[model samples]
Target: MPLALNTLKRPGPLSKGGMRITALGGLGEVGRNMTVFEHAGKLMIVDCGVLFPEEHQPGIDVILPDFTSIRDRLDDIECIVLTHGHEDHIGGVPYLLKERADIPVIGSELTLAFITAKLKEHRITPTTIQVEAGDRRSVGPFDLEFVAVNHSIPDGLAVAIRTKAGTVLHTGDFKMDQFPLDDRITDLRAFARLGEEGVDLFMTDSTNAEVPGFTISERDLTPAIDKVFTTSPRRIIVSSFASHVHRIQQVLDAAHANGRKVAFVGRSMVRNMGIARDLGYLNIPKGLVVDFRKIQSMPEHKITLVCTGSQGEPMAALARMANGDHQIRVGEGDTVLLASSLIPGNETAIYGIINKLTDLGANIVHKGNAKVHVSGHASAGELVYCYNIVRPKNVMPVHGESKHLHANAELARRTGVPEDRIMVVADGVTVDLVKGRAKVSGKVEAGLVYVDGQTIGAATEDTLAERRLLSGGGVVTVVALLDPKTNQPVEPLEFLTKGFVHDDRTFAGAEAQVNKALKRAKDDKIDDIGALEEIIVDAVSSTLRRTYRREPVVMAVVVDA
Candidate 1:
């Protein structure tokens, strides 16, 4: 969706003591879609979510928005209103709940079911209230109305948060699918009713704004996936996001139609879909689902495996199967259907998975080759449809990168909204709305807090940057004994390199550069431990670049003897 980020127009001021909307995350990026609504000192947080890390964010398992904006004012928060159960929308709930367990969470019944399962992992039992579209809840100064929105995940809502400042409609990731899979189309009637009442500010999802025409409905994927089940005479494995219960529902239906027994492979796929089935969101025939271990006993043509790792996550079930390391056998006469959108930046790994499957003589079915996947987000045509329906005074795009946001703003302008009425901003920047006008007021700390294993907020920006450097160019550690008198190394440096040096010649060459750096440090009479280490790092880096054209992370660990 990143076509361009051309600067548009800035916004003017709102009235005094107006409402402040700050996106702690989900402004400039795809994931971590959290926003704070402040009115008269009371706060309402919408969708505290998380962003999954890419290659650049090394060692980070997940990234949560910095809660510095609300950390000190935890008591000011009323309740967190969730839109859907997708990880990017609901993943950070447990992290937020860890701060204030008393804060109530409201979402659709299926959405709450997913949250409950996620929170159980952290030993947290949240104060949750289930509601459907048309359910109204007054939390402090804000009166919130949850309107159903058709997303990839079922039970998604577009919240109409009303305050004294005005009414703001937040369209959490949505699409205009007239024939939705579950028949729960985005409540356009409710949106039209709210639009008639006058929507002051509209925060819409801009994920697919750059794509022309409307997004294909979830219903569109059924025939394609059913074709895979009907045509394949071997075991069929479908890979997709576990949270896409609608897709899984279709997969189960297809298996039943083809007389195939279903088997869930990934931990999250099993846990989440099981929760979905129990909550009546997903329906399966009696004895339709068999344990993955029991699949061996069944005929290859009678088995259907649904799994996670559609993005080619290394340890995910699909990736493991592609590597032939999985317990489930996928070889000749097997079919692998990639029934999920190929996320940006995951092409290399995804292709690697496809190559492995093809090499193993399995049939590969994907969105590129077949109409097996459709985006959950609205495209340009659909965004225009929403804009025409809910004519707000001011329009701001959220849930995408800078270009996506800018593209959405232009789309709003084409809908007769003036350039000045369109606001395009990034995370941490606050938008103050009052009396049907909006403007950038101030900023907050919306930096990422990376989750590495069980360590949250322990890794800093510099630490991650170093990790990225190490990942690409590798890391070199020089351990030597330093003389306390001169802060000079008294012995030969021990060079330990990882992902850096290839042969003994490279290590031997680096050793000479290290010795020269030590000698220079001693001659300079530098005694400060920190400063001396910096010199070694600089010298070794220069050598690595000059000789090998590598910019590796060089560590100097000179122990005082």
Candidate 2:
């Protein structure tokens, strides 16, 4: 058993006997789950994750939690604790290590393996401490215990952070699955033990707080998988998130049971399953797995293909296959099973992909048609059960939007937790724990840091806004070589437009209007290039908006000779 909260060694009490908890991200949002536990000068960070960009965030690769709070205080950081191996929970490590490479990273064995592979891509090799449930590690003034928690990914853990002042329990993205596929339950006993120690502050995942009843277990998916494999006469193509090893295990087992050879598609699917198999989390029957190179020789009915793109990511394997752009193709008589959850914003893309496959004469099976995917976050009933179990003095929800957080707090209040003890805060709000009493202390400087191609935090919201504008309305570049002495154009105006209707007559009229604006500026004796450029910009913007009902980025350049 892991050491109890108060059993860990404490060197000395801090001058200030309180720990400040700041939510850097994952409050009032779905991803970029991070939090800081700071006591005196020692600080421990948790779950440095990243959020995928939405349609509004054009050209942004990923969204990160702002690092300004810990940039200068990097030396004070004890360590970074990871909860699982999902992209949202571990994607920001490369960005974080760029600033400081020596920071020790701690997580489960498979989690560390995934991180190590990602770090190698960035050419970083840092000190790693591999931990598991019932394991305890001390960092600075904080003693941390990894409590096993069941989630979408294997080896997920909830953290029990013990300090001289109080104990803070953080549930890292969990759902209560009584009979998980792997039989690794959520370790409710540990939570009960922590409750006995008297939890000061409890932060639980609120991703599905509004959802009712308990989430279906992964074991319940076995029957569905068996039916798909048993009935399908053609090739079977399965699409799911690459990190979901347990789901992949069921697919592999079903393929083997049905005498079908398995082939893993998608880069992430292959790599992540390889790590899981090597780390002993995934059990693949030997000789049941085959390479894509030999899949052609095997009969279509004897093949089982596991791939990515369950959320309809454009470049993922299943998406490419659906468009006939990948090596593996899905066609007539084949069954394409999207054995994954449909994320909130991906319904349009996912349905479009399903429609395309159906058009191609393929049978589609998804959550809408069958019992396949189950959520990894606890629902309202499970949340009530957890609140009753941990029995924390204060409850604060994490890893969800405003609605989810509000629902979770209300659930806690109804479950006998004090209404006032529940802190409903957004990103950057800090909750301070002083001598076992928790309250909202103040706010911190926390926001999102966007990651674009080859740059971190360089792509701000303003940059994305300009990108959206150009993408929607297109761009026009107006240029003129002006005679320095005449303060007038020496050449014809140059216009470049994209994503806009290309009509020579329309542009000719707009160009003439712009020249008229420039001529008016010259009559006013506007010798300054900046002033003259502004006149051309206003004229062109007004012309385009009036004619085309669009506002484009107008660039006017007056090159003086």
Candidate 2 worst ten-residue window by lDDT: 1-10
lDDT of 1 by residue, 1-561 (tens): 122223323323435669989898998888998999888888898998888877677777889988987799999998899999999889999999999997999899988998999999999999998888988988898998989899999899999998889999999999989899889888889888988999999999999999999888777778888899889988898998989988888888999988999999888999998998888888988999989898879888898899998987888898898887988768998999998886666788899999999999999999899998899999999899889988989988999988899899989999988788888887887788877788776666778899999999999989988888878888888786887776556776677888985676665666676667766766887667787777777877787788889898889886888
Query: TM-score per candidate, in order?
Result: 0.92, 0.93
What would the per-residue lDDT of candidate 2 be over residues 1-561, giving only the tens digit for each residue? 111222323223333889888888998888888898998688898988888776777777788988887799899988999999998789888888889999999999989999998898889997899998999988899999999999988999999999888899999999999998878889999999999999999999998999999998889888988999999989999998888998899999899999999988877888889999998999999998788788868999999888899988777888888798987877899999898887666678788899989988899999888888888899898889989988999888899888889999899889888777888887777677887777766566777898788888787778988898898888888887888677667777778777766666777777778768777777878779899888888988898889878798888888987
TM-score of 1: 0.92
Question: Candidate 2: what lDDT?
Answer: 0.86
RMSD of 2: 5.4
Q: Lowest summed-lDDT stretch of 10 residues in model 1?
A: 1-10
**Which residue pairs show collisions in model 2?**
none
- Counting clashing residue pairs in each candidate, in order, gives 0, 0
